[model samples]
Target chain A: MIWLTWRQHRKQALFTLIALAVVAAVMVPTGLAMHHRYERSGLAACLADLGDAQMIRQSEAAVHCQALSHQFQQQYSDLAFVAILFVILPVFVGLFFGAPLVAREVEQGTHRLVWTQSVSRRRWALTKFGLVGGVTVVLAVLYAVGVSWWFGPLVTASSGRMGYLSFDVQGVAPVGYTLFAVALGVFAGTLWRKVLPAMGAALVGFAAVRLTVETLARPRYMSPKTLTFSPQSVLRPNPATGDWVYGQGVRDAAGHLVASGAQIGPCAPPGCGGVAAGSYNWQLYQPGSRFWEFQAIETGIFLALTVLLVALAIRRLRDIA
Target chain B: MTTNDQGAHTMELALETGALGKRYGRAWALRDCSLHLPAGRVAALVGPNGAGKTTLLHLAVGLLRPDAGQVRVFGRDPRDDTSVLAEIGFVAQDTPLYRDFTAVDLIRMGGKLNRRWDAPLARDRLASLGIPPDRPVGRLSGGQRAQVALALALAKRPRLLLLDEPIASLDPLARREFMQALMGAVAESGTTVLLSSHLLADLERACDYLIVLQTARVQLVGAVDDLLAQHRTLVGPRSTDTGTPRGVVSVVRARHTDRQSTLLVRRDDDAVIDPAWIEHDVTLEDLVLAYLAEADTRATRTAWEVTA
Candidate 1:
């Protein structure tokens, strides 16, 4: 069964490997050059510590360090653009590799041929999904690791790899995304029994769930920690260093919320809130130190969802006839 | 181990179904399709399109689960018993093979999937037929592809083989050759075969047992020689339209004109015929058509009674 699965999917595997190789060809040279320039261009000097935690505020060369950071950003802007395209790999995996996995067999009427063999339908379905899905995720993890390494110097030199811009490509999340996408494709394929429609459904479904997770569920994975301040004696506040600021609001003297985020207009009722009432400005953020925790949470959510889809696909396969 | 009075060695039942049924939404693909297929006999499942032939074969192979009843192959359910799957090889409708797989690839796949795969038998058979083992099946002609499918099934060395319309798409010469290869292989292994086909001539020569299905049910099933002997066509004056003729077990079909009537009847007893009538042996095709037409009319009569 294992050998047969390889024979069936070796073409798709080869194409993916070649695509990975091409991406490597592009990332390797630029990544090496970017590393060479990280220290030589003095972007490292802008950070207060090796952690890229805070800017060297008291130094006279702070202005010079900002200039170096801006220069490095401009020089590597092309690589940054490519780095953002990394998520599209999982989408392709969903559409091409996963969508057609069982769908093409049913469409071509070949399920009747193979299911009549000595293997039980359950064994055949599980083996195919297991092999194809296992390889797809392993390759995705390797790609994610490569991208993380390539982006290491750049992210650590900026915001310590905790920002949304670098979080998705640098951790175990890619494996989850790839796995979920493939399993979603398999489920769609089994449900629809046609390859093209399954691919379309998988793409739309993957995008919708990914967007919903990223925008709606992600910020609240853990409750945002809050920082509050009085308006009159506002000090240069450094909350958790390099924290992701989620939202900001103002509270009145009595601690009733008056305005929030970017929706604040001048207080209509003249003394309802603001500096006149000693209202404090409050900011919400996920501390940068919880980066690994966030990655594990997101990956676990996607993994649970992937397992559900795989189970549904297997159940659907029994009724295919 | 039970035997008839003759005490000859009795073959076991290779396949059996009891009140087997399958439905697709509102329509019944197969209804109460209980069957008994004894080992060591090649049976033909004769039915027109939409007559549930494929449904029966699919249920037998466990590709389909019965909605109302159960199917047992060698006294074990195909769906629950994976070991029974090794003993039942099937070639599905149109002989669906992986289009991109070469014969060698498929042969290798068969070797991996089946415990009793005869690799050299598959290879030698294809080689003897001048088939190139390395060419993709999609590139092969219809005849060549069907041959490859047969080879794959035969290599499994199954005790029973179920084929659904495997030769339906082949030309005359290819159809004959396909059956010849199938018969030759089955003869060597003494495998029980239940083949479903609309082409009566092909099945007539290859099969010894016959099962005719109509309206999603089995219309008639028996050994070929017995079926041929048990049915007869009688021609007489139209006056007999009052009811069925004497000694007929049942009226299969009746056609009447101004002065004459023709009737197909089933009878196991030897009875005297009136001098006014003449009897003739019914051909297999006529026997099938009579039962089919009779079933259609019976269905209409039942439907009309409810409305009336």
Candidate 2:
């Protein structure tokens, strides 16, 4: 069964490997060059120790770091296609590889051939999903590693890892995304029993789920930490730490939440504050230290979805007759 | 094995269905279709275009579960028993083959999936048929693809081989060639075969046991010789009050001319002959068409009665 699955899917697997190798070919040299430039300009040590405040205080050092960061961003900008590709890679996998897995068999009328073999339908489905889904997860991890390496300097310098784009392309979350996309494709193929429609359904479903998770579910994984500070204070959430600030609001001395940009006075009616200094601005954020925790939660959600879709696909096979 | 009084062992049944039924939405594809095919006999499943032949064959191979009652192969419910799968080989109607795969690739796939796959036999069969191993199945002719499908099933060494309209789409020459290869394999392995086809002429030379299905029901099931021998066409004078003969199982069809009547009847037992009537042996084609025609008349009559 394993051999059969491999034979059936080796073409797609080989294509995926070549695509990854091409990505690596483009990313490796540029990544090394960026690292070299960072080292030569001494921005690595400067950014590592001085932190955001010290860097901001020393204008000369800040200027040099800013110039190096600009150079890094400009050089990396040419590889924007890679980022866009990473974002859509799972959809491609679902369309080309996963959607056609079962749908093609059914469309070509070969399900009857394979389903009648000595192996049961459940084993057949499991072996196909296990081998193909396993390869997809591995490739996605490799891609995540490659992108993380290539963009490591930018992420460190700008504290951009917690944003939507970087978060989707880094760490173990991409692996979960790939698994979920593949499972969705398989489920759609089994349900629709046609290749083109299955591919369309998978793409739409993956996009919907991804958008929902990013917008609605991800920030709420853990209750964000809130911090309040007076307007004159220099204390702000450090971007260098990759903390995600969800929202900010102004609050009066009585702790009533007020709209940002509203007037604040010390002694006034309930709707207004007489003194601006008496009010504080509070920011809701997820700290950079919770990156892994968020990754775990997001990955868990996707993997759970993967399991459910795969199980549904297998159960659907029982009724194929 | 139990023995009869004649000292011959009672034949084991390769497939048996009791009140088996299948439904696609509201309409039944097969209903109360009970049949028995004794082991080692090549049984022909004859039916019209939508007459449940494919459904019955699918049910036997465990590709389909019966909506009601059960289908048993070798005395076990095929849908519930994993062991039963190894004993049955099926070639579905379309003769589906992976168009992207080479002949050898399909054979290798078979070897990987079937525990008892006979790789050498598959290779030898393909070679003898002049099929190149490395050629993709898509490039092969319809006859060649059918041969490859048959070889794959035959190499499984299954005890029962179920073929659902295996030659329906082939040309006359290709059909003959496919059947020839199939019979060669069956003869060598002594496999019990259940082959479905709407073409009655194709079954005349290939099948020993005959099953006729129509209106989602088993219209007739018997040995070919017994079925032909038991059905007689009687010619007699036309009479409105003519009663059915005592020994007749059923009146299959009746045709009336101005002066005479011709009736086809299934005989239950040989009885004293009515001197006025003439009896003639029925051919396999005539018997099958009679049953199919009878089923259609009965269906239309029921529809008319309901409206009236």
Candidate 3:
């Protein structure tokens, strides 16, 4: 079974390996160069001294910190945009490998050939799911590790790693995304029993699940903590620490709501001073310290989805004919 | 026949079914299909298109679960007792091999998939046929691909082999060659075979047992010789109104002209024929066509009856 699976998917495996190598080739050089710049600019101390009022006020080491940070962001911003392409890699893997895994056999009528052999349908499906699913997860883990390492200097230079796109590519979360995408593809393929339609479903279904999860479910995983500031400050957590500031708005002196974040601008039918006199700026954010917590939470959610989709696909195998 | 006594239930049947049925959504693809084929018979499942031949083969091989009745191979349910699966080799319609795989790769796949594969037999067959072992099956000629598929199935060394319209799309030469390769290997193994085709002639040369299906129902099933012996053709004057013979069971077909009547009828062994009637033997092709024609007329007449 292992050899058959390997023989069938050897081409896909080769391409996957090549893709991984290409990603590595791009990552290693850029990562080394970025790390070199970060060290040479002495921004490591600036990172450590973030959010400290005394260091900002008295430390001479922080004199060139602002200029160096701006320079780093300017130099590496293009590379960060290139990393966006990595996000779609899972979608392609899901479409090509997972969607066609079972559907192609049924489409080509090879299932009848194999199912009539010494192997049972359940065993055939199990072995395929085990090998392909296992290898995909393993590859995804390696990919996530590499991307995290490569994105290290970028994260340190900007808003840590807890921000939206940063959080997507870093840590164990991408592994969960990869698993979910592949499982979704397999489940769709099994249900549809056709390669092209299953691929379309996988792509559309994956996008729907990911978009809904990131937009609706992720922010609600833990309630946002509230912070109040005097009328002078912008009321967002300092971007230097990479805290995810969810919302910023004005509140009355008595803590009654006055205006939501963007509504405070361009005063309409009234002077802005009317509300500013009594309202204090309040912000909603998740602390940067919760990075791993969020990663664990998101990964756990996607992993659970992966397991559910796989189990459904396996159960559907009995009803193929 | 001197039977070897092993146990009380010593049936020699390789494939048997009891009123098996299947449906797709609301419409029946096959229904009321009953077959009892003894071991070592090369049976032909013959019918028109959409006559449920493929459905019956699929049901017997566990590719489809019967909606209504039982399908047993060697006295065991194939789906329930999947050990029976290893003994059944099936080549589905168009002989679907992985188009991207080489002939060698397919042989390797067969070896890995079946416990009783004859790997050397497969290799020898393909090599002797001058098939390029490393070329993808899709790139091969239709004849070569069909031969490769036959070799793969034959390599399994199965007790029961089911083939579904395997040579339907092939050219005449390719079709004959495919059958030759199949028969040569099958003769050595003595496998119980059920090969299906809508055209009777395609399977008539290879099959000894006949099962006729029309409109998702089995019209006739028996050994070729038995069916031949049970049916007869009679011609008599059209004006004669004498009662039918006692031993004749049913009228399979009938035609009348101004002066004479021709009747294709099924009968018991001893049917007393009127002296005015002339009796003749039925050819296999005529026998099959007569039965098929009878059903087509009845179906058309019934459709009109419903509207009327």
Best by DockQ: 1
Report the lDDT tens digits of candidate 3 across residue range A1-321. 888999899999999889888888888998999888888877866766656221123234454666677789899999989778877788888898899988999888888777878888888888998898899889888989888888888887776788878888889988898888888989998889999999999999988988898889889888888777555432323446567878878787788777777434233334456565656667788877788999999999999999999999988876675
Q: Write candidate 2's Cα lDDT for A128-156 as tens digits.
A: 88888878877888878888887777676
TM-score, candidate 1, is 0.91
Give the per-residue lDDT digits (tens) of candidate 1, residues B1-308.
Answer: 11221221255788888999999999998898877788888999998889999999988898888999999898889884668888988898888898989999999999888888899999999999999888899999999999999899888889889988989999989998999999999998999999998768789988888999988999988778778888889898886555667777777888888999998888646665555667899999999999988888887887788531
Segments of candidate 1 deviating more than 4 angstroms: A48-64, A156-160, A229-240, A249-281, B1-10, B240-242, B268-270, B300-308
Per-candidate TM-score against the hidden true structure = 0.91, 0.91, 0.91
Cα deviation of B190, candidate 3, in Å: 2.0
Superposed model 3: Cα runs more than 4 Å off:
A51-67, A231-238, A257-279, B1-11, B239-246, B301-308
lDDT, model 3: 0.82
Q: Order of all candidates by DockQ, from best down to worst?
A: 1, 2, 3
Write candidate 1's Cα lDDT for A1-321 as tens digits.
999889888888889889989988988998898988987877665454323342123334555665676777777777777767886778888888889988999999989888888888888988998888889878887988999989977776555566776888878998899999999999999988899999999999999999899889888899988777554331423322557778788777687777777323333445334354667677777887788899999999999999999999999999987
Instruction: Kindly report the docking quality category of candidate 2.
Output: medium
Better of 2 and 3 by lDDT: 2
